[model samples]
Target: MASPTPYRDENRRRLRSALVAAARDLTVAHGWPGVTMAAVAKLAGVSRQTVYNEFTDKAGLAEALARHEIEHFVDAVSTRLHEHGGDARAAAHAAVLHTLAEAARNPLIKAVLTSARGGADELLPYLTTRSELVLAAASAAIHDWAAARLTDPDPDRLALAAESVVRLTVSHIVQPSAPAERTATALAEVFTRLLG
Candidate 1:
């Protein structure tokens, strides 16, 4: 067996990033149902074969995109929580509201959610399952924050709270009877109460 070359690994990473960015852009510009592998390949300036090599199919590509988005979201939340300092509930609330607001405005998320019916039903399942992974990631971040800030952290309880917060926010995203600001504020209140 040969060891992987750093140069080759770097190139692969670049290509994968290109594919993910292209997929996201295309999905946002066109609806999720309209985004095709060929379009992504063209947008990424990579060969169709390269796209396929990196991601087996559209579903695989979408999953990669979702994973990337989730990781980015978690990082952002972690940063915000760190910056807030000494207030776990406030940090959690701000993180939840910020994430929900982003999700509400994200074109890719909107496209997937809106096109969940008909042939595009797969989009909803993909997004919902990916959301579970996201929630797990967020839960880990919350656990770390709680451990650092709280007098005595309960990892399992914090994880459960994170999951509940994410699910509630997602519900609001799926159907918003209230305004975005109000919904976010309400969610933040609930999160603060839960964390307390």
Candidate 2:
């Protein structure tokens, strides 16, 4: 006999994903300051209580949304790294370029950066100042990729390189000084040098 536990868990997961998607859409359209729990619930076609159940407050929802978005970004980085195999510069260039290109075109990211210009970016901390989530996730992904591909790489140096690349990449995302291709090419040079 089926206990239905798996089905129940899947249903909960879908509901949570829908709620987050609603929050993302609202944020992209109106920025984080305009997003309300009631609005998210309405957009997701769920009760306000359901939104609160999944996320205790606005901060919780913001954290969840940031984490979800970072997951997508990191997955893209990982894919680019894998696609380039063991060539450190090529991998970094490809990964960073993909990220920069995505940020440039992604409406939600555009909204976040645009909101920051108006001094209303509630989610900027997740990507910068309060960046434990972003740094840890991105740095770990980079370190793991390097460990798997680089031969006899020093652990400490590798870790530092990973964090440095991530910080630099995030800085570029926040404020770009050059085009994606040029910036990625420069960062790739630095990445290889740091790895050595």
- Candidate achieving the largest lDDT: 2
lDDT of 1 by residue, 5-55 (tens): 999999889989988998888877877777888889899887888888888
lDDT of 2 by residue, 25-121 (tens): 9999998888999999999999999999999999999998999999999988998998888999999999999999998998888888888889987
**Candidate 2, run of 10 with poorest lDDT:** 138-147
Q: What lDDT score is found at residue 142 in candidate 2?
A: 86
The lDDT of model 1 is 0.76
| Root-mean-square deviation of Cα positions for candidate 2 versus the true structure, in angstroms | 2.2
TM per prediction: 0.88, 0.95
lDDT scores of the candidates, listed in order: 0.76, 0.90
Candidate 2, TM-score vs. the true structure? Answer: 0.95
Model 2 score (lDDT): 0.90
